[model samples]
Target: MAKVLMKGNEAIGEAAVLAGCRYYFGYPITPQSELPAYLAKRLPEVDGVFVQAESEVAAINMVYGAGSAGARVMTSSSSPGISLKQEGISYIAGAEVPCLIVNVMRGGPGLGNIAPAQSDYWQSTRGGGHGDYRTIVLAPNSVQEMADMTITGFDLSDRFRNPVLLLSDGVLGQMMEPVNLPEPNDYDINSKKWALGYRGNDKNERNLCSSIFLDNDELEEHNWHLYQKYQVITDLFSKGEYKDFAVEEHLCDDAEIILVGYGIISRILKTVVEKCRKRGIKAGLIRPKVLWPFPTAVFERLAKTASQFLVVEMSCGQMVEDVKLSVDGKKPVFFFGRTGGTVPSDFEILNEVDKLVRPD
Candidate 1:
């Protein structure tokens, strides 16, 4: 299997095709338009369907319809676009429909900039819209992971009967790298017993997909069921079932200071870790690949050993809150961030680490 040089967004599009995604409904947005563009052209080649819906809200509803019909469906957008789709996302989660959503994050409180940012961390992990539901969020730090996670996301979506989010950013969306794309996955749409279009004649019941459980008690029961499923996912990641893609613990064994980050910032933190080692500072890194079930166990395990934790992000500070929660004040949690499209350099971060280690 030979690797191909491709941009992150394009790689995601191709990976979805390989994952047997035959339906895509999304609106174009900066830093991620390439994904839709690639799919618009490539999906047809594979006899797939691609629709550039009029708006993000409409696009997500379209995804819901297709997913309910047992199709491997997907959608892509940036920060603001994802915001508009939140209500529909919540509905999908509540209805227990399976689909893949890609959010190529950009600077934003209100369409801030086309620059890369991780401001959506809270929204992605905290169930952005109404209701008490969760979407499995996967943060990829590289172009290769971008492709790999897209494939993994679809599989997870189906396995859990829930939506899966590939939380990327502008940097990863636009960057180009060589990716060894996975072989095409063979999926049976009719095998979804819960879906409306099952082919097996043995099925005698009608499958209805709807988030509206009018009765309060019925909704409560549904919510509790969703909670149990989420717990199962959290347990799996904590137990290292998906450790390879859940989190990356680099040089944290005996490190006194640990750095925490995800997405592209993790790549920078890795470099800072190397530089810290050269300076004789025991610095480690915790990169969460699965952001929703956030791999908090790693932070909990390291808090007793590591002196302090420094969380780096592209936003002013979002993920740091999660780190603090994970560490539970057992160790100090510090944060360093640059917003408005400004990416922090390795030198800037190493200096922060120096201050933490050699406080004046």
Candidate 2:
């Protein structure tokens, strides 16, 4: 009920616990290690399980095991660590198991730096692994959102019977701010009749959770089913079913120049928007709270009025492509990015916006 100063990573750990996540399996990775460290100290107090697995690959598989048994399970990692868990993530998705994956992104292509970056946008939104699967991606822009999205990630995972990713970055993962932690959620594991170990006297049907459909037709049918589910999620968000979980439109009503960003970059863009308005530039922002099932409809609507769109990120232009596709040539889409963990200042972004709006 009260607010307290907390670091983003630790706040996320506490939020996961409150979301009824009784099982946590993860390997330590920078920018996100504090989360598992906090859970190690806190989970035991609540009778939850905290396991530091031998490898990132192992950690994700453990999540698969716990989630298959109808438990609220989660795993976290940084960029390279997440890459290692891709196959396991794919397996979990194929099996349609409910779980949460936290990716506190860092600079990368190799084992980049421990510093923050948004270079993983394509990997996160396009299903990083080798499959026709989709993971629901939720991006948080602040320390408070890091905690809030963690709770929402778990609920959405269970609701859709799929993995939900909280795509944060090193900046938000390491930042400290006051947050109002929510009350613990009440989860009924038995309500998940599709999961294994659901208790219903002696008449419960044996539940099997597996992604291996040896029969070609069976696999094809399964893939189609997953596709339909993804369509439903995209359609719902487009219809404004989930507010605050999809996109945030700031001052975009009559904006001629629309700024786009997500995670921590959006925080910076908010300032740029205000600065542009102060300068009478008619600038606004469309921040995608959820990366996948991207708020394409929003862009389509704004493309009619907005003369151009500028996408700012902590890495070389990634999300800009999606904005381009969404705008679909109705209006020009531009991009400015800083790579290798560099964060762009509001003034730097404003300069980019000036070139587009002024062009003198």
Candidate 3:
């Protein structure tokens, strides 16, 4: 595989096509419009379906329709536009449809700004729409991961019979990076045995795709089944990435404070970790690449030994909530972050850690 310079948005669009996703429906939104535009041109070359939906709501419903028909479907949008699609997203999840959703997040609270920010961490990981549902949200810090994860998300969604979200910020969507493209696989729309498409000779044997369960017991049964599936997913898929530095007897081995962050901010924090080590300050980073099934066990072990935890993010302490839940009051969990497109620098986060480590 050879690396090619590609923007995150373009890479996702191209990767979707290569991943056998033959249908794409989405409306235009800032910082992510390139995705749909790229698909518009490329989808035709592959004889795929590309619909520029009238609205975000319509786009998501189209995805639901395609997904229900057992086609590999996908949709993309930015923050405000994604809000419009949440209703359909919930519907898709309720129907137990496998689909891929890409959220090229921008600064938000309602069209806050068009810069990069990880404010949507809570929305993507937690059920942003309604009901007790979970979307396998994959956060990509680099353009390469953005492309690779878009394909992996579809595979995971189909394997688990659920929706998967590729969460990326505006900076990632717009940035260009080298990516080794994957070889296309042969997929037939009518080949899957589980697909409830228009087939078979007997009418009585036809399968209906729907989320509406009229009977109370039937809906409860469906919900329970979904819960069982989620349990299987969590058991097999929960993972995170950590960058450990060499620590002596009383450093990370018996340290008091641990720094936690993710996404591009986590990359910056890694540099700070090196500087902190040079000055004899003990610090390690727990970067949750998979934010939803949030490596709770990994952090739990860290909490038992660490004296304190500092959460750094680009939101008003959204991910900090998850951090607190994981640590479960075993240690002090402090938050330091900037919201609405204001990102803290490596030094800024280090200063906060220094304050916690050397309290007066």
Candidate 4:
């Protein structure tokens, strides 16, 4: 495979088309609008379907319809647009439809700015839609991962019969980088026996696609089954890459505190860690690539030896909740961040680290 320079959004769209996703339904939203525009041109060449639905709601329902028919389907939107699609997302989950949802998240609350932000971390990981379901959310920091994970999301969704979310921020979606596209998998969409259109004149064959279970016991049974599936997903899918400098002696081995972050902030935190190392402050980073099914055990192991943890993000300490939960009050977990498009600088993180290491 030859490596080509591509923007993150374009890379995702190209990856899906190459991965044999034949149906794409989406409406325009900032920071990720390039994705639909790219697909509009590319899908027709491949004889694929690209429908700009009347609204995000319609787009997701279109996804539901395509997915039920056993076609590889996808949709993309920003935070607010994703919110509109949540209802349909819940329906997709209920129907066990396999599809990919790309959330190139922007600033939040309501009709937030178009700048890049990680405000949708919780929403993506914790089932942005209603009901007791979880979307397998993958957070990618680079343009390459954005493309690669889009393919991975489709595979996982089909394997488990669920929705998989490819969560990226506006920064990653707009950034340009080199990516080596993967070879197309030899898959036959017609081979799937459970697709809605495949139902025929067989006598034992009354299959109904629905999320509405009227009987309470039946609903409970369905919920338990989904829970078991989630457990399997957790065991099989949790993954991440860690950069531990001098981790043998605790990140400090001879110092006091460490900084933890992921996504773009983790890139800046790496610089802070290097600066701290130069000053003999001993710091390292634990960047969780898979935000959902978070690497909680890794943090727990680190908490046993690390003196303190300084978590950095671009939100109002959203991921901090998970950090605290993982640490289980074993040590001090401090949060430092600026929300609503105000990204903290390496210097700012360094100052926070300094303050934690040598308090007032």
Top-scoring candidate (lDDT): 1
Per-candidate TM equals: 0.98, 0.98, 0.92, 0.93
Which stretches in model 2 have alpha-carbon errors above 4 Å? 201-204
Q: Candidate 3: give the clashing pairs.
A: none
Give lDDT for model 3. 0.82
- lDDT of candidate 2 over 231-349, digit per residue (tens): 88888777756755599999999999999999999989999999999999999999999999888889999999988999998888899999999999999899999999889999899
Residue clash pairs of candidate 4: 249-253
Better of 1 and 3 by lDDT: 1
lDDT for each residue of candidate 1 in 132-205, tens digit (9 for 90 to 100): 99999999988999889999999899999999999999999999999998889988788788898665647476
- Compute the lDDT of residue 123 as modeled in candidate 4: 87
RMSD of each: 1.0, 1.2, 3.7, 3.3
Cα lDDT, model 3, residue 341: 79
Model 1: residues >4 Å from true position, as ranges? Answer: 201-203
Tens digit per residue, CA lDDT, model 3, 119-235: 888888877898778898887778877878888888888877799988888878888889988998666677545567657536546766688889999989988988888777776
What's the lDDT for candidate 2? Answer: 0.92
What do the candidate models score in CA lDDT, each in turn? 0.93, 0.92, 0.82, 0.84
Q: Give the Cα-based TM-score of candidate 1 against the true structure.
A: 0.98
